[model samples]
Target: MDFYDKERLTALQAKEEAQWITFAPFVFQATRVLRNSGILTTVEAHRQGITLQELTEKIDLPAYGVRVLVEAGLGIGLLVLSEGKYKITKTTYFILHDELTKVNMDFTHDVCYNGMYFLEESIKNQKPEGLKVFGQWPTIYEALSTNLPDKAKKSWFAFDHFYSDYAYPEVLPHVYAFKPKRMLEIGGNTGKWSMASFAFDPDVNITIMDLPGYVEGAKGKLEELGYGHRISFHPGNVLDETQKFPQGFDAVWMSQFLDCFSDDEIVSILTRAKQALNPDGHIFILETFWDRQRFEASAFSLQQTSLYFTVMANGNSQMYDSKVFLECVKRAGLDVVEDKDYIGVSHTLLVCKPVK
Candidate 1:
């Protein structure tokens, strides 16, 4: 909340801006088409700009189609027309070339776009009604493990990895500072963090606990990386109250993991994690807490992501505020030992130890 600026718009300006909501979907698809149809890329390549005729010939679209799309793009400030030639704007260049933007765009379009239509119903039922767009699953994680479409899977993982992967290098030093010989990774999706730990120290052994499908996927990845011997796997649903977390870990890792569950569920998982740890063991949690964001844009993006969780991911989870998350940690009997922010793009690492 502190990250956003106060709205101080005039009445006329506020009304003008409000109209954008009406045509937002049209603009979204138009920009997507501009990117997908090679219009943005083609225009980017030509610093001097390209005419509609030349653009049509380059991308194999009809002149009428090119003109209409280019005009729409101009209205959106993604493109500009100067002296009868269409040029990519700086904003469009970033949209076309920025990795984060590309990943987020793909994730919104391919994964969360159509499903978001059921947002109202999902809110009403307190369940992910939008999940019907993909298949009947309580959560998207189930669909991810089972029958998610390939393109959606690609975008989903891309969005997931892009945010957390940047923080690995920065976070590795903190994890290694403990010099933990035995580490446990909760929610070890695809073993990216596990692999990082193994590479950080050959002698360190990692045990990844996650759903069966994720454990299997991590096993395959570790095997391919030749680090299978250094890592072990435990497959179980962490949300099940009857599920006992494996013990004997010097440190527990949950990178970008806790936000996937509801507040009560987070407390439950953290309590189980506390039980699984040695008396002196620590838990490292990496997440993009909305309240901890350094930039307004980061906070806004996470707010939108909360809606994705509401409509498509799970019914109740969200990109949490740090205050709420810390309350859960305290409720689960953990005390923060080290709180580091801005690790990589937008992540905060909270190092916790069991409260005495």
Candidate 2:
């Protein structure tokens, strides 16, 4: 990525950035509280701005509590003080209203905050040590279906859907270009993509393969939505090296899924996909490779996301650099016949075919 090619910050700026890192946890919680406690929103409602006393009068918080948060907000760039009144900054607007930012923030707070403390342990063990904070599971995927708290589950789904759902509109036509009748979607959580596929294509049938719990949940939801007839399911742990992927689909799709696994696991999954390929059919992989992003902010967010894997998702997997991820794809005995980037928010679609 052109984003991180050079050291751009001055020495003083770099030292300040280091302090930002050092107090990151505090700032993050402070921001969340500001949003949740309606401090940010209250300031937003006052178009001109709200003074500490005025804001406290509008909300239930103690005046002192409101003052400190507003002062902190000033430093954090979430607020601006103009003539003794606190006003929402662009960052505050995004933190309060942006769907992407909201989803990411909620995910980090509700699902990842407590667990992330075990990051070092996870890295050392090469397992999801953070996952134990919720409950014991080999990985976060297992906990997602049954063990996660209500807020945590909601946040996780919101986060996952926010990332991939936006890409559906951009990807469907490209995928349907192959005009495949039957498709297999591994890691098709809640059948959202399948619903998108059905909406985009009149006659295509999809089978979602996932953990038994997710498959069952998706089936119920699809059935409720009157898509049961056109849908099928193959419930199994895709991570199990012994279990071969269900074979012979014209199109195989994975979106924001492969990055959940280590390089070897990703290769194994793709290798199976290669073996099961319909020769004329294609495999579509949609991921946000850190190096392929159009914005430095996006790249920075993704680089930070790698630690989420190292701590919460699975210790060995990460938000990968394109070169590193493609090396895994190459090892899987497939060739990227089509490479498309900038899909939806920030995703790369790699249309692969079995190496001939």
Candidate 3:
């Protein structure tokens, strides 16, 4: 309508766009800090003393370029410069450089770095224009595991680091709602969710299923939290464990776990879970689903969700609305009595009951 109204709308839009530009550095800075720190904390660094000259020789970069890189790193507090020598920061030691640490600096550098570059494209396209945008790989995980550079793999280990942030707190209320007796956590890396539940609700017994390697680190996490008694580590493929799963469990939870597969694979998984559940057992699905109708859907929360789908799940990650999810559940012979949005920056929660 009026010029004044149009002017106000344009200003609001401009403000919103500027916020993301301002916030982009925080995202990039974290990745840069983590990546540089990982190198400094490496065992090789300790043995040979990874100075700018050594780093240049090792990586085959120019000496002048290495100096600039190291300087920027030092400026960001990721690298300590003292007595004409370089060292890693404390933040990098535990999270990035400690032996077999959860956070992977290389993965962030490769996967997340590219994802951020396309933020504006994603916002404009209303869908991720990542590698898969041009029909590249089916999923980013597959591409990375097979074709990604070694440096990128170093950062991808950070995938496990994100588990705690994505699943807990948001899913806690739902877990409590079901009041589960024998809880089975599929792909429960580090057992953080299980440990948190076991502490809050002492009556529950939590079974965490993950690959054997991830389970190795989870032991310390469980032991550190004094949850060794209540939590059990079962390492195996989740699809293969359906027959052995204890029947009649009050709840079966898959958190941010399903997007790892295609539609056919998801149906297969859900079908198996349906068979594993008792007549009245419940299943919880939590993930990001894009609402094509809402412009506000392109906000920061949505952007992050799309980026993960590109970098991790490839484009196969569906922002399924309740209707789409319900169809899948019903296809698996489950009935959805309640589906509600969880408390988070973005996404929805579906609570399903097995169909008799």
**lDDT leader:** 1
Comparing 2 and 3 on lDDT, the stronger one: 2
> Looking at model 2, how many pairs of residues clash?
0
Query: Against the unseen true structure, what C-alpha lDDT does each candidate score?
Result: 0.90, 0.89, 0.60
Please provide, for model 3 over 106-194, each residue's C-alpha lDDT reduced to its tens digit, 9 standing for 90 to 100. 44445565665665565465444555432365445444435555555545545544544655676676668777787767667556677
**Per-residue lDDT of candidate 2, residues 211-308 (tens digit):** 99899899999999999899999989887878888888999999999999999999999999876667788999999998998888899889988888
Every model's Cα RMSD, please?
1.3, 1.3, 10.2
Candidate 1, 186-277: lDDT as tens digits: 99998999888888887899999999989999899899989877888999999898989999999999988888999999999999999988
Off by over 4 Å in 2: none
lDDT at position 181, candidate 1: 86
What is the TM-score of candidate 1? 0.97
Ranking by lDDT: 1, 2, 3
